[model samples]
Target: MPRARVSLLSLGSVRQGLRDSIRHLQSSSARASSTSPNEVEHSDFATEVEINDLPDGSAASERIAKAIGCSVNDLNAYFDPADPSTLSITAKSLKASPQMRTSLLEWRQNIPPISLRTERAKKAYRRPIGLNAAFEKALKVLTVDKHEKYERILRLTDKVEGIINQFNVKAIDEIPVQKKRSEAYLTAGLIRKLRIDAEINFPEVTSQFEMGKFDMRLPVYQHLVRARWEKNDRLLLIDRMESMHVIPDTLPTLYPQVDVKVRFPGTNTFWIDPGRVMSTGVTASEPKFSIQMFEDSTKLFTIVIVDPDTPDLLTDSYKTTLHYILSDISISGNSPLVDKANANELVSYLPPHPEKNSGYHRYAVWVFEQPNCEPLSTEKLASFDLQNRDSFDIRRFSQLYGLKAVGAHFWRNKYDSRTESVREKYGLPQGLVYSHKRYQHYEDYAWALPDLEVGDENKA
Candidate 1:
């Protein structure tokens, strides 16, 4: 009995210490010269937490309660009975260990099932308290190193759990999102469709998005690939999500600045070109464009294409095409082959071929001249090519180039809160929550893991 009590106290204290470390790092890492490993681990861990809505009647929860030798009512008491969406355990009231730290295994095996069920709620409540979220909040925490690196071990465990959850691993993945109610099975009786036996498994790419895994992003992009390579029973290649790593965008800086020329906005009849940049066309017959310069003041030209007819098998099926014309201000030449006189300027467009298509595909093409032009080599875009180059993979490119991507256009769903800027949706939302303290920027009960120091890196 004393051993059990000691285990509980150690678990609670270590949890508290971790929370303290995480909060401290999240709050002060930006201002401090150095940050603790505990802090970064917590932030990364918080991201992997799956906030799913638990059913009011969880057979699993009931079975767990029975396995632990606790009465149903006693088990329920330990969890939050009010919010059926979550089982919440209050960490604030728990007893702490005399040593004020706990081992990873203790919490996993010792914590009653009912107590585990309330983890989400407890985590939510403890966000402001500064726990090392990555250590304590994972579905399953495992490690061989537990000396001074206890915090990092915890963070890695969280990451491992998140990877498992992202790929929908049954026993390992425990985080739950909101439940979906789809009655489309009503058409089960009218089932008359082609059958395809397909196998799905998450492939280890970078550890986050397994190649074998099937997620919303994969299906959506595959649909785009189908539309792109239409007319064959070809298989589209999509990599796992783990290939994504957070890095600053680097392209916009290559040029001092370039003018943005608008040629055409997409229309109902035509979808935007994936290869060309959009420009405002002054006239339908002569087609004039409005140009805006970036910080470098280099004159740039653009072309736009809108193709509404592209088969949108996926819910997000609209497409925009961009064609960029960059001119080198240093070069001077007169050429009739091209309307632009700058010898340094080059025109590049995508969907590489438009004339070959028999169907009506709308495309916009605009030309602009920049004060200075920095040529982008093929090697710069090699990753994009490997990743299918075209599709919903726009964010990955913009992120790499440090370019403020002006979205061509996309289908809006009910869940989309248009109030947030596009950059926030694609790039900065997580950063915003992590960087700031005011809760108003985020939602109630929605807290971010504090900033953490990575490896031996000092605070920025």
Candidate 2:
């Protein structure tokens, strides 16, 4: 019976039938190998034996001779090369045979070598075609494989979710067992101290914002690095209105300078070197002073200061250099203001609110050539006191200085009605002004009031 029919029988009978089929195949293979000569042969050609190994007309030699398609004498021909009676076949001997050569040539032609060559060419060309088709088939197979992989991945994810849910349940049950106790020494006092320290440094931040679980690992660097628990970037703990206190106003668009010294003698003028500083901690509160050109003339002039390095400080008297652009007296008209005034008054007008302009005034002198450059106009000099002023005198002094106009702004002292008696006595207007006297060499004029003692005044 067929194996399928055997399966429909009883279970015990089915097991016996499978055992019998397996035994039958094994016995048939063994009997075939043992009994059959051709089946037992190692190669496709007839088996042969050496002459030296043959026994004289024995059963074994006869059996061996019978196995080959030749007699014993024919086998002897293979061993004897020089014997006139011997016949042998070797590769060279075969090539010399005309029959073999003609047969081989005919056989080669019948094989259709050109067709074989064409077939080979086709096979070579078809390789890429077959490869491409196989590649496309492989791509389709890969796509199916990918789909299967994705399905497997989805199943794996579902399994992972199930595992996670089981773990979460177990974790919930073990939560109380794993609960960590608070440190014994931790108290409200320590918390308060920590909060107080944080509040002192970060007053804008809050206690609620500062509260956090202390990172035990970062305890060493807690005080060095500035940090807080708050997420918001900026905080205004107090209202702007409540924090309102009067701040010193900035005198906009003007650089304030202190004249430490000038070229003239008698008056003490201390010029701080641009390279020098009182300290790295002190920075310029005023805008930087720069020079601009006036196209009207060629005048070489400069504001030189005493090198703070010479005296080790700016308190000592300074030296300055002022080069004259013009030598002809005829070009400059006779005016007393030209000699008496300083550059400050010539550059700007005094503001009505003198308090607003109070500080060290800078006088940035520059040189420019001129057919004319937008006429020397004053934009910030709105409070000029020009009761007895002459335009020629102001212009001459401006030309002499090499700058279009002096740029003046005060930063050293706050302008007060009483403290600055010159403003009160001379009827000086309270804003920026263009005045001749403001540019006079500091040595020729008392650059500052007596209140600014400047111990080196006696030397000047």
Candidate 3:
């Protein structure tokens, strides 16, 4: 019968039939490989509707029940918990049900494991080496048990928080009275002690406490501040002074033990950098001084600001002019801000007014510690008048007062557009513009000139 109904097929029809057969074979092989012999095959629809049943007293069942705050049997109808192989199925169920996910999260947060809490607390309060040995030993003796240590940390944290909240509102200027400031420093001292003894991170509280201490100039945190100055600012100041000849020109030498900061209030509120060039207008106003002393004991200090670039036409050399001088100034680690009320203004502030065509002038600020906190006599103070300020000798002044230089700072100024206005305001005389002088030269000898006639003859 097949021979009688034989039909000729085209090449295209044969290729299409072969492709269909290969595709069918691939599909069958894939279906067979998808399900292992041990695995039970279920329909996709059936899997979506199916629920795994949890056995009693299983670990997974207990965990799910605890997390969801429900009995294991109560949740058995909706999802599988005891079957370890149905993890993906349970995850999908949890993802689909927001109520279940939220409940599980709440349960976890409400009842964290005791072991985890202990481990976390220990890690958070771990002590670092290289700290003060005596302080660490004291802490160890006080907090022998974990519970004791944690409780102590909590108490100190509360105390520090209270102190910060109390003083954070008031500024340094607002708390002008010494008695109230002393009380604030006492509280800050307590915070410092806690920080050193606890040896634990206090995050925001520690930083706030430090800011308070710095503003109040408390001695408790002076070491940290001193260390910072010694490591960076001190070295930079020394380098600038030595390189610019401010050292020998102003003073013999400097061995700074304190940190000196200079700022012009109306012009710039920020502290001026060491050896920075300032405009005549910016330096016109009296500068604010902050002398950070490392010593705890209060002592009298003398601040001398001199310009070592003033021109003396008579001698054809530069003379050091006293720009400003304050005597009987009190300063210490616990009180760093310069108090002008208790100070004697030897020479009123004379703003820098460099002459036209003159180079940069160095305004050297020297802080000298007095021998016995003695005030300058009236005679000595009167001697530093405007006339006497023109030729000031710092070496002689320091020798007379028996003063030791503890801190030094300097800034530069040059003639600018505002120099004229400053000169007028200070009633200074007109500045003379200097020009380079030309010198006369002798005529050259006849033999020194080139022989033009001989060269012309050689060319011919």
Candidate 4:
């Protein structure tokens, strides 16, 4: 009976039937393998089974036996699946008869290959194909591979992968573990840190976004390698935001900056680097950065601290809001902002308040070298309001007043409840939280003083 019919029988009968089937297969295999030419003369059982299993059955066996000048029984006994000699002998006989050889070759070619019998399995994300020829060759070397040096690469590849494996991003979990968004974030970040030598395309990306292209394993690693090779990539690329569109890394746009050695004065007593984040009130308090002004103390200079990430990050409606500006400030060999007695107060410093819902904000500082002992005129200067200024332009201001940027740097800021007291001190009325849905934006209060008066006094 067929196996389907056997299953419908009683439970005991089903068990017995399965055992019989398994035993039958095993015995047939064993008997087939053990058969020999000498023993087969005494027993026709194995010979009959082997002849039946052949493609042409007994007819092919007899033909092979006649071609080899052997008895049909001997021919079957001598046949071994592992030995190619028996197949060759059969083929020789089949070739002697052209009609049989043609039929055999046609059947052989029509049979499906072993590899094709099984279904093909595919990966969720397909990595971009073809490695850089030199990189591929370098990777295959055993010594380089053992050192883990070849793995780092930063090709401006248009693909990335496997960041959002859909909630299966558990670092530790049972079944149905979803991947965290941070995994993708961290993977992209590591690429910005790794060492690799490759060119970064500054041209506007016209095609698809590269980060979501392939699996994170190799693509993330390549970016890390490339990032490290970049001059200031490690210093500037602090988070996932900068890695996406790295306009901050370009120097020509904002060139020749002053060395801003940042130090958080609070209890944490930590120094600040690019992308380094401090808490809202404690460490994120107004950071004091010291820059040695080679110019004479009597000479006037301008210091403008602005935030480019104003009015929400997505839509940068307000590009560079003049947060704190000190025009005609005294700069000595020592720090200029140190002594309030000599320093002019055009715009006082205000701590960054990212608000509860708002994301990370970049609080940048731009130091401009003012005109060298010339007639300081407020007539030509653009009418700038500290309280009601819209999109402020740094380059335009520099050109108008014969000012050049001397030094520049920025640190990241985020929101926390600890900043509540600080916000009150800054007299924040409206708050940085303009809207929660489309991301909170910085209102006028966040960028400037409520009511600030502009002075045309020329201390120079």
Best by lDDT: 3
Q: Whole-model lDDT for model 2 versus the true structure?
A: 0.28
TM-scores for the candidates: 0.19, 0.16, 0.55, 0.37
lDDT of each residue in 280-382, candidate 4, tens digit only: 6754455565554422234456667766656633234445666676666555443434344544556666667666666777766666666653433567653
Candidate 2 Cα outliers beyond 4 Å, as residue runs:
1-363, 367-413, 416-418, 429-460
Q: Which is better, 3 or 4, measured by TM-score?
A: 3
Q: Rank the candidates by lDDT, best first.
A: 3, 4, 1, 2
Q: What is the C-alpha lDDT of each candidate?
A: 0.29, 0.28, 0.64, 0.45
> Best-fitting candidate, measured by TM-score?
3
Report the lDDT of model 3 for residue 138: 45
lDDT of 2 by residue, 165-256 (tens): 54353212222323211121122123323323422322122222344333311211232222321121111211111122101111112222
Model 4, which residues run further than 4 Å from truth?
1-252, 268-270, 283-286, 293-299, 312-319, 332-340, 373-376, 380-382, 430-460
Q: State the displacement of the C-alpha of residue 345, model 2, in Å, after optimal TM-score superposition.
A: 12
How many residue pairs clash in model 2? 42
- lDDT digits (tens) for residues 143-247 of candidate 3: 343224334434544544444456563332234466655554554455445434432332332455455534323323555567668999999999999999998
Residue-pair clashes per prediction, in order, are 79, 42, 0, 22
Q: Once model 4 is optimally superposed onto the true structure by TM-score, how far is the C-alpha of residue 197 displaced, in angstroms?
A: 34
Model 3 local distance difference test score: 0.64
- Regarding lDDT, does 2 or 4 come out ahead? 4
State the lDDT at 231 in candidate 4. Answer: 46
Superposition error at 263 for model 1 (Å): 6.0
